[model samples]
Target chain A: MSVIYQRVALIGLGHIASSMFWGMKASGLADEVTGYARSAETRETAREIGLCDRVCDSAADAVEGADLVVLCVPVGAMGAVARDIAPHLKPGATISDVGSVKRAVIEAVEPHLPESVHFVPAHPLAGTEQSGPASGFAELFHNRWCLLTPARADATEVAKLRRFWKGLGSKVDEMDADRHDLVLAVTSHAPHLIAYTMVGVADDLQRVTENEVIQFSATGFRDFTRIAASDPTMWRDVFLSNKDATLEILGRFTEELFALQRAIRQGDGDHLHDYFTRTRAIRRGIIEAGQDTDAPNFGRGAHSTGRAE
Target chain B: MSVIYQRVALIGLGHIASSMFWGMKASGLADEVTGYARSAETRETAREIGLCDRVCDSAADAVEGADLVVLCVPVGAMGAVARDIAPHLKPGATISDVGSVKRAVIEAVEPHLPESVHFVPAHPLAGTEQSGPASGFAELFHNRWCLLTPARADATEVAKLRRFWKGLGSKVDEMDADRHDLVLAVTSHAPHLIAYTMVGVADDLQRVTENEVIQFSATGFRDFTRIAASDPTMWRDVFLSNKDATLEILGRFTEELFALQRAIRQGDGDHLHDYFTRTRAIRRGIIEAGQDTDAPNFGRGAHSTGRAE
Candidate 1:
């Protein structure tokens, strides 16, 4: 409810940063938030929309006197931004990142940060497919989990960052860096890649017109497209940065798909039925946890009772 | 609107059948709708819910004098139901089905039907993850596409069936049986198996506890689970019945997934970004087609702006 950070610097003006800015403003979590983006157009849009107290021309300028400088750029750009802003960071400031891949982000950014600053790797597990300065709101992080891979960061600083994220309306939890990457690989990265692949396959299939696929997509393919439509640069960096874990989970996915494919080919109804039934229970856990809704078609459109496809 | 059929019979009491019953009742599409389910419990639930004018103890009894008898059972069970009710179907009645796969359904049901009865196979491209008699609602088919694969049925009967679906609040389209199977394979079947495979992989991973997957699944994996959570018996029959197309699309899916996986392995950002970016256009088409909303998370929960995961 009160100011948790006197000065917060956001080094990217996309969905997460703009959302954090709005969330902070809505909750009165910070005194001033300075923002910067690689694209001048993005900075202009953020400024026009009043996304932050100050929209700086450069990452270094944004971090000049900020006590909390959060790297909100694509994972691949984290190191470069970190090196660029190292000299300009305020004394004893805490440097954190909202990257999907934690181990790689810590590896990419820690060496570039000055010893005076604290480096806490955090990942907020929430987002819509849309990405842009304007496509964010205060409710983006409401009831969402923000996992912090503090690694060896000072306990006090980690706690402070946790409090700040809490103020931004996220439930905070601490996780080991490698574990965080692996968990996210299963939860986000691999699923995203699979969705992208499925959507791409549909697009490439000449036998089925794209119009037909689009027209009949409401049941299943539509959900995959919403996920596959997420910001390309950010997802590209996620796969590359979290390559091992994502590939591992995807390997398992392919193996399972092949088995199910074999069952379908063999007309093994029981095998298919058992596997399908087993997976249903997992969704029950998610709905019970309030991580998702149990509404039909996600209670969208006409079936206005529950959650998504 | 006047009743399209003087007496209608729904042979199964499940999500689609119950919903159709309610939909017809809401619109007065049929004068008297009779219902029967193989499961007595389901029939009891339908009777309790006022699902139909009469709850018959047998499929034959339900179809005794019905002008339109709909088989809303799983694809694999269609042939048996068709055989059981063949003797009792009225001389000039129209028989239809709401199966996801059409080619196999036609082959299985056509031979059992008497030459006098018109058979017009149909599949509604709409549902929630929930199943059973209690899950049905009057608005389940509102504004959704109900695909008809009418293979050699009388034009008048086909038109009447289409009219009935329209009265039930659906947009109707006629597609070739084989083409419908392939189109649905791409849009629904393949996506479902892939989603199931992904969720299964998450479940089998011992290192990442189910709780972690449940808590962190809000963004990506959550959508997959909702899709994968669909009725197992229905999906099992679908895969067995639509074997060739499902396998073919999944083959393409595996190929694309491997290609994307390689891009991740080789750290090829351009390949990953291009594939991801290309897939995004498909969602825009789907949203524009009114097949789905652009609202975030299908306008569910807090982020009520656009569509699903």
Candidate 2:
């Protein structure tokens, strides 16, 4: 429960930033938190909701005299936000970001940051279909993995930042920016794209009828619908920023899908059985590795559990 | 709580059958429920666990003198089961099935049923990734949808069967057999196939490493793993039985996926944004239509409010 930082500046008041603000306050990890958002309405909502100790008028104002400045914007906006606040960042301050794609973010933000500040690119692989400041809660980070890709960061500064995330109740791991993006593309981006695609297909079906889709969705399509409900702006930026890795994963996905389609068309029951059986084992491995909870956990709310949907 | 039938027969003692056994018994909808499984081990388990009042050695024996007979096997096994029980079915008995694909099931089963029996093809859109007798619970069907495709049958029998499902806490809808298959292919089969395919893709990635797939799965691929963990035999039969509809939906899915891929590869942010936005609205529509619960329900174990992971 020890305070990790005296003053923390949150450069965006979206789901991640608001969750971090509440988490830091609830854990007593930060003595003071200042928040800023691109829209006046969001900044006002952040202040009114008491998500931060103070809601600043601008990103520069939020970072002034702060010990830590964390950018939590869409990936496409990282460079502009970084440049906008660079002049106001305190000397020797540690700066970080919670963006889904890391390599692009590091490339976008590092050059704009002054050498006096420590830049650590991080991604907390935790979210819900809901977005914005109103959707965040204090326990969103509990027991979730936070990947940190610190480029040439000082040892002491890196340790301090790691402790900051750990204090927020996250298990931390370190990886290179490019590797992080690649892993995420396989794990998150490709799956999300698939969900979007399947839901779109269902929505576009003129013959099936929408009522039937809604009534009988409990089978499997409902899962895709849940995933497809994620914030549009954030995901749009993710696909834009991590184009190479996302495209690579999508290619592999489409190839496997085509093979499965052929198997189905040929009535190759054994091939379908083998593929399904192998994938079942992978799910068991995920459960055994403590990466996901078992099937019964599908009714729990976001803040109450660390398991991903 | 009135008993709708004096005796009910369950032809397969798997997840759905076992769940129905418990659900009917718990709701006091049937005075006597009998069960039969092809394997002696399963029959013994049913007896030991008291999954049914009587455990018959054969499907024909189970159906004899029963007012209702429920086929709960894989779709591929339904025709044979119907033929095996046809001679033993009580005169004027109501026969129904719980299969994923309706049109193929009716085709497979109707030929073998006696003209005196009323055939109602049903699909309860409720199940977990787990299967077998041990995986079922009494509350598994609560708040779920049950779709029934009754042929030109006795109205009294259809109403009685609908009441039986209602007694188990399911809202019932009736549709034509061919239309039911097409609707489910879009809403259920295709989504499951996509899930299986993506999980397979992740499993095939040699460079990423299994541990990485497990550790970083929170990104998106983990959701598909859960769905892919479903019973392989049941799913294989689903695709095999409903081949035409599934292939048709899969074709549409692939075309849409390719379009999205081209957009991403071309770095067309607007295209990604518009598509993602449209999909998000569909998800919202699903939530509003009451097909999905809005609560983030992915981590809570059964019988506990705590999130599982």
DockQ of each: 0.56, 0.54
Give per-residue CA lDDT, model 2, range B135-184, as digits (tens). Answer: 67777777778889997877888999999999988888888888888988
User: Compared with the true structure, what per-residue lDDT tens digits does model 1 show for residues B78-124?
Assistant: 99999999999899999999999999999999999999999999988
Q: What lDDT would each prediction earn against the true structure?
A: 0.86, 0.85
Best by the lDDT measure: 1
What are the clashing pairs of model 2? A187-B220, A188-B219, A188-B220, A297-B298, A297-B300, A298-B297, A299-B297, A300-B297, B299-B308
Provide i-RMS per model in Å.
3.8, 3.7
Window of ten residues with lowest summed lDDT in model 1 chain A: A300-309
**Candidate 1: Cα lDDT at B98:** 91
lDDT (Cα, tens digit) per residue for candidate 1, span A1-309? 988889999999888888899899999888999999999999888888898999999888899889999999999999999989999998899999889888888888988888898998888887777788997778778788899988788999999999998988789999998998899899888888888999999999998899889888756788788888889999889999989999999888888888999998998999999999999999889878887666554435542221211
